[model samples]
Target: MTLDLYRADLGGRTREWLALHPDERRRRSVQACATKDVEALWSLTEAHLSLYGGSGLLASPHTFSAYRTGIRQFSQYAETQALNLLRLTPDDAQAYVLALLAQGRKIATVRGKVASASALYKALRWAGATDTAPFVGVRVPKDHEHPLTKNPPYSAAVLRRVLGVVEERLLSACGRERERLLRARTLLLLLAHTGLRIQEALDLTWEEVHLDEDEPFLTVRSGKGRKSREVYLSDRLVMALRLDRTLPRRRSHTAGMVLPFRTRAAAAKLLKPLFERVDEQGRVRSDWRGCHAFRKQTGTRLYEALHDFAAVAEVLGHADINTTRAYVRVGGRRAGKVMRDW
Candidate 1:
């Protein structure tokens, strides 16, 4: 086996694992290299994983993890088909697409996998590891262009309903549970009013908030791509945040964050009950669920009020105005409003 050909290219953790399991590594490498096609596929995937881990393509850890999973899943699928990376064809790529569809994967998930796999192949071509780019310009299935395009934004009344329910629950709870409800309520308000992503809110620290300022805003230092932006808070949101700051602590907070959770999972656990209640009571007007829907709602409201895509993009901290457009989903509403007013 030519394990030495790519041994140095392994990511830090992969290399460490290989070092710890010398016999297993030897066995796998031998198995991978026993056949010409087998060695080529294994080497290409390892190289892809190595490049992906080091590329810093996606900034958020959650996003990076998803891309990694997608790539691994595609590689496994390719292996099952006895595909060779060096001699891949567009037909092979289409077969994989069909296979994903046959497996009943969601359109979004299938698209993500295809994108990740295509990107990996692009990287391999750029590195001069592959002779041809098979997945280049491959099209995913129809009606699966983008996830946000399919999901309509939640209504303002639904946002108010979510907040009202949380407030009502807070009034009846006590002790640690009360604090949990309070945190959930504050998060819901912030998401609805501020247009901040849930992760940005979860990672927000007390020090990042400037409630005493003339115009209160949060300093999002750990935003996507580690980019920093000032997200202004509404008057009511500022007041709620201020009161939350002064409230007595129950569970210990980590990273000095405003919320008790240092991770998304913990925050999900805290907010699940409220979301379930929302689902049970049919407060949501659309199929779009989760905290991110609040971001879309805020973006829609801002676009409606400001009528400036650039300004809305700036508020949402979107690197691309097109992404902001997707979030806002303005479509013909603005034109209709102008026509009616004129």
Candidate 2:
């Protein structure tokens, strides 16, 4: 089983899986754990998670996945220099920032890398990975907040095609696969209209969706730090959502958000499996694809249709208007135009 894929949800599961290996005994020594500075590395990572009060990030797959990947990159960078987190001097952190600058990276880009490293230190301290903080002198400034600006909202036509693909699969698929496809289709369709994040969509429960009255809407009880919001559901969504609500759920007893394929990491494992199942039973390259792509896809579509930054921001639920504004800043003006293409 891909227990490691669920480390954020169930932390000890990965450790349990790793303990099963025959070589685990040899690898468990404290010296080996810290050899080449891995201990120091883990220490910093724990600290980062703690400082942010990462319950939001942990529950939100998009941010959590990015944190894991970003921290891994930072760890590798430190490895190249044979530096340990416990002994991570301010000079080392400063030099890393300078390296990004030398490479002609923008200040925003450089800040992300540094902030990631600092976050590691926070998580590490919380986890008791380190007895003391590694970065005492280096102060982590408030994170640079900006909106997603490059990807325009999806146009009516592109939204049609994306939903069209999902609708096609729902009819053609069979059994559990068919059911799963239907759920995914429903999710994509809802996002195209409502501007809900994928995580928010996944968190839906039957009780939360109200359609008995003339007006229909879903109550998002908690999202990204337990904030609640009410989104009026489109008539089409209110009707279509009933399909999955009737099916037997794996965990929930009633109608709910139907993305029941698996954990967020399910796609990472399924990319190859799905292709193999229908093809010549051969392996396909598992590109870094996930559900987040669909979220971005729909968001861009909405941006195009509305053409108003505030409208896009409201749909996206960006705490700061600037964060929603970032969709335009993504690649460039040319890229923004391209996103508007059907």
Candidate 3:
């Protein structure tokens, strides 16, 4: 069952779980696992994730969704083996890893699946549900490929072509079509220049956008880890936003979302046709990654120009420099230039 359905079955009991004393919750969790009560066990797992996970802060909705996906997959494997998930041994964890590999799952996929199971067990243990550390030392195969080879950033030519198409479409359209095209163009430029995550950009409000200041910037109130950060605007993005302001919107200037669409799906629906258009070479580029390619392109260009991980991380609002490093690609042209100097 999906996590939401499970919660729905629990109904008011979900609130009860939160209201219970810590000791009572632990006792109930241990009893639930002993009796193999799947529902109660799941409740305890959810409670732990809601409270104790994410370094003691409430975990984000995205975190809960990811864990739900991982746990659901692992539960399916357990059903096939007639294995009690809470009572698993170290061998069971190892066998599951092997089973995933035998099914031809990538190393990264296997690792993600295993990590979710590990997190589930960790939550159970935190609630005194079980002492069985099944996932301990359960190794996943390492990927030998370089990180840069995966999810390569969009090229400058592609970014220019996409914006060009959007502008071209704007010139011929009127009314609603013109409004949508304008929002699409502004959204594309914002993603390409600011390196904001798709959700972050969608969540922006007019109040957070500072366009009249000496150096234009926007405040991301709640980013990945519920942390806030300021991202300075590019001149191109500033001009686009200024032009976008002239469009008739339902929302007021001081309040409501800056973007017309509230969800990624809506934004994608409006922008997908632009990506599907054939290029000058008569080849349809099928590798378009929606808004993410723009974010990656921003990261790549920033790193290319600055050669500083810290600067890129700050722009991208990444807490970890290591994560920022993965977004950069050192092309052959830059490598050749460095060698020429030698």
Best by lDDT: 3
> Which lDDT tens digits does candidate 3 get at residues 1-342?
655323443334456677777788778876765555645656666666656566433344445566667777787788778887668999999999999999999888899888888877987787666788999899987898765566677789877887898888888999988888888888888888899988888888878889999999999865788678899998988988988878776755424677876667877887787777665899776547767777778998998899898999998999999988778877676889999999
Stretches of candidate 1 off by over 4 Å are 1-58, 79-88, 102-108, 119-132, 141-149, 246-253, 276-288, 330-342
Clashes of each: 0, 37, 0
Alpha-carbon TM-score of each model against the true structure = 0.73, 0.62, 0.81
Query: Residue 331 in candidate 2 has what lDDT?
Result: 43
What TM-score does candidate 2 reach?
0.62
Q: lDDT tens digits, residues 1-342, model 2?
A: 553434443344334333444343223322322563444344334323533555723456555556565567666777778777556777887777766678777666666666666666665444444554444455334435543432234445545654665676767778988876666557656665676765676667767788786788778754676667777777778777877677667765333455555354553343323222222567454222344444555556566666677766666666677766555433465577898995
- Worst-scoring 10-residue span by lDDT in model 2: 270-279
> What is the descending lDDT order?
3, 1, 2
**Residue 76 error, candidate 1, Å:** 4.0
Instruction: Please give the TM-score that candidate 1 achieves against the real structure.
Output: 0.73
Kindly report which residue stretches of model 2 are placed more than 4 angstroms away from their true locations once superposed: 1-65, 98-112, 123-153, 168-173, 250-257, 267-312, 328-342
C-alpha local distance difference test of each model: 0.69, 0.57, 0.78
Candidate 1 residue 132 Cα shift, in angstroms, is 5.6
Error of 1 at 294 (Å): 1.2
